[model samples]
Target: MRSLDFPALIYILLPEVFRIIELFHFHKQVNMYESQITLVMDTICPWTYLGKKRLDEALAQFRASPSSSSISFDLQFSSYQPSPSRPETIPDRAAHALHEKHNDNEEAQKLFEEHMISLAKPLNIPIAFTGPTGNSFPAHRIIQQVQESHGPEVTNKLVDALFRLYFAEGRHPGEDDMLIEACVEAGVGEKEAKDLVGDKTKGERKTKEDIRSIGMDIDSVPTVIIEGRRRDLTLTGLKEVSEYVKAMETIKKEST
Candidate 1:
């Protein structure tokens, strides 16, 4: 391409060229075709921990691909409580998981627990089902506040911390102090987290909107919904990394 000498060019042409430069920056700042992923999950869900690892792996693969490098992946997480009606605290989350997963089958319960353990081995992310179950509503609220003020990168950190506290540390999500500590460790200030800790109005509103945005009621945990490029993708429950890879590929094709 030949260089344009703006100083020597006519004033009218210079205005047009300036306009072109402005448009370039404008488009670069906002591209609607970029993938938008919304993960709806509860903090107590063990499989969600695994699903997140797989999604990260899939995204890493996408980032490495030359063709996909030009686009961006926008991630947002929504809150979903498995037992919404229950109080913020529960006696035994481990037993709950067993019953929910195996449906009272002892052999299947063992296998399910084993599967959860095995899923985290290769990813290097730890998870265990030996903790108490608590309402994830408050944690969800904190995430919502983080997402609003700090953006997705910080929000992701908070999410990882919450999952770590729940599964690896055996901490209950119902407690506000634990959530506040996790948030501070994840980059949120102590005062900021405490102020918004148990406040669920914003989180509940946004979560309902997120569910409506996906146009479906997510009954189970670990559900992922990706929107953009004329394609809407949803993956529920456990799946291989290859599955997420394929979904991204399909989205890339539709976008083209």
Candidate 2:
């Protein structure tokens, strides 16, 4: 009666051991890849979509350069909700743009749309803003869940899907079903993903705290940061491709 079952106790503690291994493996992969890039973005954000495309272009150029081919890239994602508490059931996007945060002026709406269209053209993003613009809190949770459970590559896939679904394709990220579909496409477990989306404020609270810790709060989406051994660079919104290239170059130089 005094002695406990050692084998049974070992099984009970196995999951925690696996979690430790997973964390170790993820960081191992990151170190192997050599660069740590964190993108803090909202899913339903148009400018973030453009930012993603721009970042991709910059990375392609950076990698194609003869001197930098040896440097591998690891893109980590952080969540940011500029306006997390907006209504989840808005049926129109343009109206959301006009009412939710922007002033309720007709001309302001037109300019927003016009600028979006111009940005969409370069990447050939088929965005019409024809449908609803739902709340972004759920999408952030899914991205964070994948990043924490899976890895940066898997998380990048989910973030890409969310942006494509919300901006290029005609789907609102606020819908649970759409988010579940996105998770599945990103190689996330469908069942577990639903549970993640159901829980609010899990991932984004830490993102908010992270931004605050650095003495700056997130006031916008698609904020990309390159952290190096000796320096760090930050960019917000749709920065030029050359600017992104410069950021990566700075990181590489500092890393060396």
Candidate 3:
């Protein structure tokens, strides 16, 4: 029943007021939208590699911008096989395969390579038409395993290493040596890398399931699907960095 002064009452309630404000902010953060980006691609595909690079650049730019302060992103890679029937190990016949795909037209193959090289030059990605071209199943399996065990950051590194190994270094995708080297480069221990590479059957079923899950809708590589709160955005093939940024902005707007 004792009377309290204004300053005493204010002091007594200040801590509770701060606590309430903290709770409010925490709730707001908890409810913030997260966009999930799934990149459906094949390791041997040059266009998918370019698409991944462009998407990475776009995500970096968007994260650095003021408008993306409240947005969160989760990027994941899905497996796709352009030539599912190719053997796990094959000789270096990429050029021949390209020519065959182009109906034995050398000019068409040359033009295709030239266009890819031009696009890659600006991004500093070395476009090579040489390397073992065959089944990418083992490579996809390793990627899926790494993603499951190490999460997205390490998986991204592994994917980048695999791309560089196959495209830039002209290494075989499904070879044990190549897989071990890529895993090591991505920060996986050498022993684990070897073990993972040794078991070719590991992650095979899941990888195949993932490929099948993509279904008939995505009949191409480098297809990116952005899952937003209200709607989803699908981007097929390689796109400019600005375009990816715009897509992120659109998702953010819809989220709010």
Candidate 4:
């Protein structure tokens, strides 16, 4: 009877211990999520700011799930100039002008701002529409310099700074100091940022030329292009998380 009791105890205790260990491992995996996203943005677009915030929340939710079907990914940054040819003092004249032209006609700009605020509320992101419409050459050039040297991660940091400054703080994105500050905050050397902006006469034209080479239409600020096997996916305006996730899933499946 004693010998039988010992083996029974061993079986019961071992299974419980194994179950506990399994639960811990499952918890850890559920908390782990590795994925990447590419955000193509122009600070002039309030929707871009809102879209990014929502995308981040969605990605966070994805990471919190424990599905073996899910794989890790990265978020990459892409450049888009909404008003590539606007003067330096104003960065987003096209969208604003369209808004003003509509005066009493349900202004698209007002509609966009309202939508951005609503979308941003859930993610604790704030956006306003007081920035000037102007050239993005100075800012893009700094980003280009970062991309050329430190790579996309650096580009991402600068992009984030731009969003915060324009959307939340209502700062003019075209202001050289604002851009320089964002660069420095992102670990860009002050001298390099200055050099990029200081050489704006040559730099601005070259920046526009470089942006044009990407071959994207300059009609909108937040253009997201996801390349796939069947076709290239292009999204403009403010997008929801579900939309981005659906596109990402399609791209992932095609690649696999």
Candidate 5:
């Protein structure tokens, strides 16, 4: 009873301290610049690659402004498998496979190809999808390892390289040689990267589990998720850069 006052004051002050800490965190989130943008993408998605390039351009423009010139953003790359558990050979020959599937209606395939070509035109990249369309699970598993061990910057670089290899160059990204080349390009330890490719590590398992937990049945590539107040805002399929720009602005405003 004699120490009741002190105990009461301690309890009161603890909540106040927590409030201050919460306020500090809120402010920090609002002002975050260079490290704010997180790109959750899949290697197979063409539009994710295109959307990211466009988003990066917009961010560059933002950074160029006199007031925000010094501000940099944190670009974090996350994993998503558009076609999980699919056959490895399918991706290697995506164009042929898809074309054959749509053989009854040539326009069905041509229309899709036309969209891909248009997206690549602005970036001065060409895609023929001549090779394999293998399962991305193994490759995505490798990506998880890179992100865990190397860091976000390394992951981002590797992701960009993979995107270029698969979408622009139309190579089989699921191939070991191609993936190793991408890892090396990102400055990752080549031997370590290769070893971890199909290791069934915790991170890889978690990524795959998360994708399924969300119940996302992705039929196509380039699904972009914009983290919003309520949950994630998803952009499915190939979208114009302008749409991404608008989405970014909305996220910024929401943060405010």
Candidate 6:
């Protein structure tokens, strides 16, 4: 037999070695489990924003863990309106509405505000009830349209932008300007966003249907539903990051 040169031998074997490595990675990816996390929330709800931030933290923790290699996640947001009776554009500030809800008791309002601030402090979210309170239909419509067209990632970004605009910047959530700005921030073209915002009737029926569907099951915002392999896990209200991580671990264990 003729002697094989070392360099030529390596060159001949390198293609097969790379092919095997590629196959291994492809197989691993194919075998990973997929979990869907659906968040039912409104754009203007401060608690919902906190919930989203916490859930994101939990997901990051889980992704960094060893179990993440076996699983993938799909995050989605569903629309819900806490005050469906309010007009699309309201003149009263959110603080006034909150105070009115508590029968205009200044003490009660102060206590509630303090409670919100305390809860938000740990999460690093600036909870300001300074913006105008309205129907939230416009924001919901824009989010629904984005979700349909751009998928969950973009929709989540848009939701975050809207939250920041309202809670941190004290802007009206239902205003066209806010919606358009959020869309642009979420990577949608300004013209497309304008078109989406200009069409007043776009996503109205679907938003209403989603609101009705979600409302029938839960009367609260920030309800999270995780669709797992065996059964669905529902987490209501704001939860600790560890709690969410535990839920994901349970799902991952079941996946095995």
Q: How many clashes in each structure?
A: 0, 0, 0, 16, 20, 0
Ranking by TM-score: 6, 3, 1, 2, 5, 4
Q: For candidate 6, write residues 26-123 as lDDT tens digits.
A: 99899899999999998877789889999999999999999999888789988888778877666667556565577877788778779988988887
TM-score of each model, paired residue for residue: 0.79, 0.77, 0.88, 0.69, 0.72, 0.92
Which of the two, 3 or 5, has more lDDT? 3
Tens-digit lDDT track of model 1 for 21-120:
9998787656535778888877777788889889889989987886474466878888777666666677787677567666878788788778878889
Q: Candidate 6: how many backbone clashes?
A: 0
lDDT of 4 by residue, 178-234 (tens): 988898888888998777667767445655676776535646646666655455566
Name the runs in model 4 displaced over 4 angstroms: 1-38, 63-72, 90-101, 104-112, 201-206, 215-219, 227-232
Best by lDDT: 3
What is candidate 5's local distance difference test score?
A: 0.69
List ranges where model 1 is wrong by over 4 Å: 1-32, 98-105, 198-216
Candidate 4 to truth, TM: 0.69
TM-score leader: 6
Candidates 4 and 5 compared by lDDT, better number: 5
lDDT of 5 by residue, 131-160 (tens): 666777656777777877888789878887
True-vs-predicted CA distance for residue 97, candidate 3, Å: 2.9
What tens-digit string does per-residue lDDT give for candidate 3 at 1-256?
9999999999999999999999988986887787889999899988998999999999999999976766788899989886688776668656656655787787888888899999999888897888676779889999999999999989999999999998898888888898999999999999999999898778888788888777557889899998988999999988999999999999999896
Candidate 2 lDDT score at position 166? 82
Q: What C-alpha lDDT, on a 0 to 100 scale, does residue 29 get in candidate 6?
A: 90
Give lDDT for model 4: 0.67
Model 3 poorest 10 in a row by lDDT: 92-101
